[model samples]
Target: MAGILSLVWFVGSVLITPFLMILLCIVFLASIGKSLGVRRLYVKLLLIIFEFGRANIETAQKGSNAEDTSEEDEEHIEEISPLNSNATNDIKHLKTPNGLKKPNNGYVPNGNSVISRDDKLILVPEPPFTMHKTDETTDLSEAKDKCKDYDLCNIFDYLKAGMESIIEDQVTSRFEAEELKNWNLLIRTNRRYEFISWKLTVMWVCGFFVRYFFLFPLRVTICFFGVWWLTLCTALVGYVKEGDFKQKLNKYVSVMCFGILSNAISSVITYHNEENKPKSGICVANHTSPIDVLILMCDNCYSLIGQSHGGFLGILQRALARASPHIWFERSEVRDRHAVANKLKEHVSNPKNPPILIFPEGTCINNTSVMQFKKGSFEVGSVIYPVAIKYDPRFGDAFWNSSKYSMMQYLYMMMTSWAIVCDVWYLPPMQQNEGESAIDFANRVKSVIAKQGGLVDLVWDGQLKRTKPKKEWRERQQEEFSKRLKVE
Candidate 1:
């Protein structure tokens, strides 16, 4: 019994001592808001492994293709006969670049169709086919006269475009995960290259164990302790008198607490143009994930505005509200735009309070593009500070698809991924021009962000992820079709 007890005690020490040490180190670094350069080093190591894996995948694919070519040749010889020459020609004529035979309808295959990385057919419509329309319209008889002159071939363009949209749409793809140019060895990523080589397989197995078993536990420990620390610290800070000292303490506490939490994902953020950081105005940014709040909070404190949520998000929201002037509206209250605007105006009127951080896009995008920004925030008439955040997909996917995954599941994926790497840029402050509409102002800000971040500027609303396209949009498309038939 004595020998068994000694062995058990020794094993426990061996397992627990390193974990305790790591915890202490993380806490110390988080408190000081410093890093030991380990994250960048780890990223660099990953790039090397990824390069090796890519080489192996290429080599393996070449060998496999050679074997497949021989087998295909033998099968082709057996399947064909001298009398089937015309059938073979017919087959070749039907073949498309996508490797699928086109339907036997009158629609001719067009060059405008592109095959995206995910094997989806992307139809690049002609610019004149856009939904935007002018005020000019012709009389019914005049339109009829033009329709008589319309070329029959033009109708095929519409048919092809419609079919391509049915296969895959431009808007829906933005809500999905962004594809990576090279595989990063994460199973969750879009590519599956781990099985191509034994070296990659071994490396992937080790990485899986490290991420799920070691990194995940460590991250959860840091996050759990960090949450409690934030609650306690905020509670203590709330007791301080309302003055500059309190403000300074609040900022310090927010940065330190959020810094600790961000450490949970081993986040590596690079901020540019710090001089343009928001001081006393409405701060807007493109949303990719809930981590955007944590990322920005680590650098500077901002009064957040969002609808109230429950569960883990709720705990964080309640904790934050304790120390800062955050606005969390109930679901019903959110629909009252006037009330929300009044609150926003009141908050911005106070010079001492931090600038209210708002994500005007209103939903998380896949980080490849900036969707339409809601005009409500721009209508406030305050100096708008635009922020752009772009994540490196080669590291990990940062987009959150709420419809498909719950908050806890999303967090689990995040915690188990390699790391979160992103860049934040603070562009120059913008204001709505005189006589300019709110929508135009919002579009102007969105364009600036999309340009700076090298993201595609999309005019589509982000809310379309949860809702169908408005009925009027379909009607407008019909109107455009009628106009297309009009020769002028």
Candidate 2:
């Protein structure tokens, strides 16, 4: 009877255990979904709160600054005005850039000059006026109609205008009307909706942390799924959104897995000389666009060492760094002059992670010519591998082409343009022997890069080649010094 009971119990345990395991898995996945949903909701709330607060603060600050500026302008006007008690009656001609002459004779009660009160001159701050009310229902036509009456009014009319004259003067003096075209270009580049969406998405993902204690396990699951979901969303959204090549590439990678293509292409193109690869050395390349980072990472030529923007982005990069051994430098930390150099030596000395890629051109340029290379990257005693990249005509005007357009604008240009292609040329490794200066090494590498990429004319020699100088600066200076010495 005891043996029969034991057999029954064993059978029950085996049957129940599998059912329990399946139940647990279902619960875990459900909890994860719930956690992610909550986090996203929280993020939206937080963004709304922060945006309202920021807008209020900005508005207040701008108001205060304007008041201060108005007071200062009043003092300046008084100082500049010629001493004639009755000069206010005499029509004083004020010459404007557009050849519009204004009578500056009337002094408002507050002692400010009167001018036309168009929205461009008064209510709106500057070009591409962003001060328009978000609500379309708010009618500004009445205010605009009142503005035209400024021509008929006297001193009292000018004083009634209040900040209008001040706003106009500030806008005219500090902001050029001609710059509106460029400002419009900037607006197009940084598409408002795309930027806002990205920020909100990032925020929503982070909001889950607030409830981590109760939802820790679920949060982890949510994170796993949310990443792929967000990536998909961002990709679809980015593809539709206009931007420059780099911006589009970044958006494509972040939202979808399309970046893998760019990576594969770069890896295939960059010379992979296992035998010639330096055990450890500085890898220097031309800065065409920010996408250049993606190219370097895909090539597996050098470990990235730079500031890490924490959060999901940080986690993704950190995971990649683990495989590639990335060294993260925080922006807040004081830069140790020798620290990076020493680190490079250590990494190169090791069997793993031999090459460190550096963009010696400290900042991004239009890619028409190579900018002056910064000296620090060359200081690492290892051989320098100079890489030069040239974009195809399809991307000529989009990639590292101009500062006038934003990332989105550039991307749009790329989409509309012909097939996007790039040429990557890697020069032979440069070794620094004893007593070699970083400048000399940089110049040597620059020369090699110029020749390989057909960009020699863009370098210093190009200037000398066109419009030959009669004498060098040193020679001219010496000639001047000789004459001075003779006089003495």
Scored by lDDT, the top model is 1
> What TM-score should be assigned to candidate 1?
0.82
Stretches off by above 4 angstroms in model 2 are 1-280, 310-316, 395-419, 456-488
lDDT of 1 at 430: 97
* lDDT of each residue in 1-488, candidate 1, tens digit only: 99999999999898779878987887788778788988889888888987877777667766767565656655554464242454344333332111223322322122112322222222323424322234457245543454455677656656777775665455776887775445678864323567777888999999999999889988888889889999999999888899989888999999989988887898889999999999888999999999999989889989999899998889888888888899999999999999889999988888889999999989998888888898889888888999999888777788899999988889888999899999999999999999999999999999999999988787888898789989987786677566666655
lDDT of each: 0.78, 0.45
Model 2, position 416, has a per-residue lDDT of 33
Each prediction's TM-score versus the true structure: 0.82, 0.40
lDDT of 2 by residue, 1-488 (tens): 99999999999787557645533543453323222243235435544644543344334435546665656655645654554433322222121111112332443221123444434322212211123345767566543444333233323323434445453332122111111111111122222212234443354344334233223333333334444443544444444434345333433333223233231121122333334443346678776665676554433435666666676457555544433456777775417757767776776666444366677765554344564566667776666877776554311232443335565455444333222345576667887767878877777787677667755212232222224534674475445334322311
> Per-residue error at 119 for model 1, in Å?
22
Query: What value does the lDDT take at residue 322 in candidate 2?
Result: 32
